[model samples]
Target chain A: MKQLFVLDDKKRTSPIKVLLNVLLVCILLVAVFWLSLSAINVTFDFSFLGNFQVRIWQGFLMTVFLSLASLILSLIVGVLSAVGQNSKILFFRYLCNIYVGFIRGTPLIMQIYLFFYIVGTAWGIENRFIAGVIILSVFEGAYIAEIIRGSLLSIDDSQLEAAKAVGFTKMQTTRYVILPQLVARTLPALTGQFASIIKDSSLLSMIAVIELTQTMREISATTFKLFECYLFLGILYLCLTLPISFISKRLEGAFNYEN
Target chain B: MKIEFYGLVKQFDDDRVILKSIDFCDDIHTLAIIGPSGGGKSTLLRIIGGLILPTAGEIYVDGEKVSADENELQKYRKNIGYVFQQGGLFRHMTAIENITVPLIKVHGYSKEQAEERAGELLGRFGLLEEGHKRPAALSGGQQQRVAIARAIAAKPKMLLLDEPTSALDPEYTTEVLDIIHELKQQGIDFIIVTHEMGFARHACDKVAFLCDGQLMEYGESSRLFNQPETEQFRTFLGKLLEWNV
Candidate 1:
């Protein structure tokens, strides 16, 4: 017989980690606050948020419009790529494979530069917003395509066969039975992709699209308050990303608890 | 309705033949095909369900030569409900949603009508309470029942069940068999591929013993069970009954 020692009557639970994590967060917040204050003089002015609010708000709107436009294009590309990959036809399968590889193999930033400078300029399109949206769509579409493909493959083969057995044509089966399940399964990935799109909107600054971070960069250059501007920008980015994160988590929880 | 398999042969490459010129006919409500493993029983069922084509022969459904025409085959398949060995439930849909799917997608029933029909079937299977549960949340037996309910919710003219109870516990086996027996009584034609001799003897109207991709023995359940005509069937029966003993 083996003898074991039980030190405590109760097992240690999440309490310590919760306390430590909160403390760590507070410490990080203090350090960031201290650095921000030390880097620039503290001035409480509501004018930037009010006087320049229109420009900032316009940039915010532009960011949202760019993200939405890119999302729509990416949705079409992603769905098509996923379907092509799942197609029984060899040509379509190979085509989708090549598209995924070509997009994912290259860095998004390089692609952005290429689209903005080479492609858009060559086409005589001066709008940076158009270039930004197109680049982001192509970049994110590849990732979204993979997510959709995985979800489609994750579906049971028997379900497809069952649909066929019921006299559903291939198109009908794909449209009705397969697509709904795919959408539900890929919901989280879509939310994640949307969050990435929000952060990636900051990259539009390079293209002079004057989105959130660009607005901050411009104001900070004139005001000489890089810390204050960035902190505000960080808070704004968090505002944008946090809701999407919350919705994704809620969707995941609902899906899991549905059964 | 009559289903005919005429000299059906399925060969892989030039050497191996899974089903060799197999000929069978059935107009009965319930036809059970019993055989040892790898006897091509499932291949036969798949061919009848139009899931797979016979490489050499033609299959006629209800006096219509339907196999060659792809479009006609699609229409013919509307009347069949195939329950694979695994429950093959969506795993994502609630039990009721899975059951209502065929009605909504293929039969063109409205969502409300589909749910109503599905609710009735779930109630019949004693799964009304479990209707909102996913397949993963349910026990194996419950999942199997949900699969069967989904199959029949389409009100298919025929049902093909492939070794449905093989993966189930004994208690659950009885539950499924009881449901099948009830379905048979309600005049739902069934083509069952089962290893359960007890279900074949008690529930199935007729039994066909297949071996080596051939129907070696087929007759009324009594004759096939008590006095199997061939030595191969006798060996198969002896091995199968040995487990029961």
Candidate 2:
């Protein structure tokens, strides 16, 4: 038993042992959930999946489209706000600061309603999908800006001085010294934020956006199969985000320099 | 280089005076400012490099007043090179790129011209093979040498090195000092803040000893090292050389 736990100098565990342990842990997780699910009065029925296939597929596609569109828009907003937060002009700095502060201080669900009902209505944005994407983009943009700003602040003052000493103009310094370092440090966090954007878009179901969650909600309401719908919903989300988290982990390692 | 300072003062946060009033002048091809740490040596060097603005003072370098305006400062900085305690090389860029990028971007050299000049400097500094490596991959001495090469690649009017070898081992320190000696022989003007007393005494023409926010002594390096003045400087030299072979 002791030898089984002990590793050789290389510290490499046997592949067979690792695989077996992983399988056992997965089996244990499923068993626990199955035991609870069996004890509950609710019956598990995925038969409705076949009946509502088209609606669910469309909802999943909507979620993907919303997350993808918001990801790109949020990233643009993030880079601008992050750089703006460090701007010499007070107006740019304060605007970025207040945006980040307000979005972070309040809840996202409140922001979704307020933006869709008040701001979106005021702006004549009648399409629920467009309003939902805009709201999600605005919300995620603030968090992304904070992530970028944190990495920006972590850059050494010496780097700036070195650039100045070499006579790099402000624009050139941003292009050469600041941007490369910024990309290297912030890429992983930004990728992780995309995962958050996917999860957060589910809340747009509240506004009747017809996304995956809304489709599932509608289906469950009619079928009275809440648990089955939600359980399958989680599996579908994992299918999207599990690969993202894996990529995020790989990116974190890829950017790791010894310095 | 004829350099003059009139009532130079630098304070941080209005309360901490890193440099009390400083008035000094010197005309030397190679100058070294040496003293204990936290003695305003690096701060004085930074003001000379136009990287920092003194709170109250006027500086004249080679009969030209170093102004605090942004445009004038950028122009002034354009003709000078500065090396910080760390190499301050872009960590993401390879050592050669560290030298070439600045030359191409800031100095307006073509990419080929920049690469040629960077290659020459790397070879001169014995970093030709290490040129492909980033600062993190290079050794401390290599990083500092790359910094020195980067600083001199544009052939600046003056080079300001703030303890370039402070982070290196004794072996690497000797190597960096040797490069400075070669630069001195080549007759490129420089101002260095260093703790290596022997290099200060031998390699440099003029020496300024700063301690406790004041310039206590300034003279020819040979004469000053041989015959010291000021009780503070005398004690400092004694303590420093006491451990020497």
Candidate 3:
């Protein structure tokens, strides 16, 4: 009975393997740090971070707000655009196609600039954060649309037929059957797109948005510690992104029906 | 319930005719549609279930004409229970959830009521233990049982089965056939498109033979199988017998 609980060799992680993996990662990290410090001749001190902690924290909060807002807006845009692309109406399908094509073809930075300088100005939108959110949402919405469309297409035609056979209206079929499956199928892609959104929030610095990158740039300029400032910025971005990646992975596993 | 198809014509691109002008009306509790591959057997079933629209035709279920408009079709479809050959149970839903969805969503049963009904159906179908398992986790036979349970959950006027046991092995096919037989005894009307000749002969009251998108012959199962009126049906039966042997 005791033997029944013993893990098979394939399932077990040997202590030696675990120790070696940890050792390798430590060595690699140390080597990179030493190399960077030696090459730049910068002191390995993060003391300057304390002075700008509040500013950095504020910027971090803004970044989170921007990402979450853009993510929600983009998801709405994505689902609508995907549905438009899939619509039986020729005009709607073509319109969605043009939107997806134009966004995907142009550079995201260029789009942001265009939106801020021209569209926002024309619309009398003065707030930089709102403008940034709009730009990011539009940019990410196109890619998310494609992701959603691909996921929706991946569902078998029989599923739709089955729903119809059971007397589910087109709307009911989409809401109850297609949407649930689509959420599961697109969760990983959606997560990746969200992480991209967080990283892209850094681009708002160009438009004078007081996000993490902009704050770090200000700190570096005042202190003349570019490398250290950039390193902390990188760590800050990781702090924002790593949790999203981890949680989404857990969600992906939980939603996985294929297994 | 009586089902009637009047001058049913299905054509694509003004050239390929899947079904030519056909008129059929029958009062059948269990009708078996048997035909060669590429015949309009599945298409006919789909048309009846409102999954496909006929180019020129009228469908009457229980003497009420089924309209072509989407909303009207949906209302008409509510009275139908269609089962596909592949046992099209939602892969993400458990067997019980598959049955409960129509009950809760379409029929407006409360969650608890739907679950209770689902449990009763699962128990009736010998799938009580498999209720929590998703379609992927269930055997082919079990999935088909769940599909049947889901179809009949709404208590539709009639059930349409398209090759319900085609994907199952002999043992599983027998299991499904047994369930179908039991359902028939319960006074449920069924229109089945099937390749299982033995089950069709034994279970169905009427048999319709289709070939090249045309209904060649249709009559009582005893007369159609034992003393076929058409040469096409005779040849088809000979081939089926040879293959079975």
Best by TM-score: 3
Error of 2 at B97 (Å): 1.1
For candidate 1, what is the DockQ? 0.52
Looking at model 1 chain A, which ten-residue stretch has the lowest summed lDDT?
A1-10
Order by DockQ, highest first: 3, 2, 1
For every candidate in turn, the CA RMSD to the true structure comes to 4.6, 2.6, 3.4
TM-score of each: 0.87, 0.92, 0.93
List model 3 lDDT by residue over A88-133, tens digit each.
Answer: 9999999999999999999888988898999999999899989999
Using lDDT as the yardstick, the better of models 1 and 2 is 2
True contacts kept of each: 0.60, 0.79, 0.66
Alpha carbon deviation, residue A42, candidate 3 (Å):
3.8
* TM-score preference between candidates 2 and 3, better one: 3
Candidate closer to the true structure by DockQ (higher is better), 1 or 2: 2
Worst 10 residues of 3 chain B by lDDT: B236-245
Q: Which regions in candidate 1 have their CA more than 4 angstroms from the true location?
A: A1-24, A28-51, A86-95, A257-259, B12-16, B108-117
lDDT of 1 by residue, B110-212 (tens): 9999999998988999998999888879877888888888878878878999888888988888898899999999999998999888888878878988889
Residue pairs with backbone atoms closer than 3 Å in model 1 (clashes): none
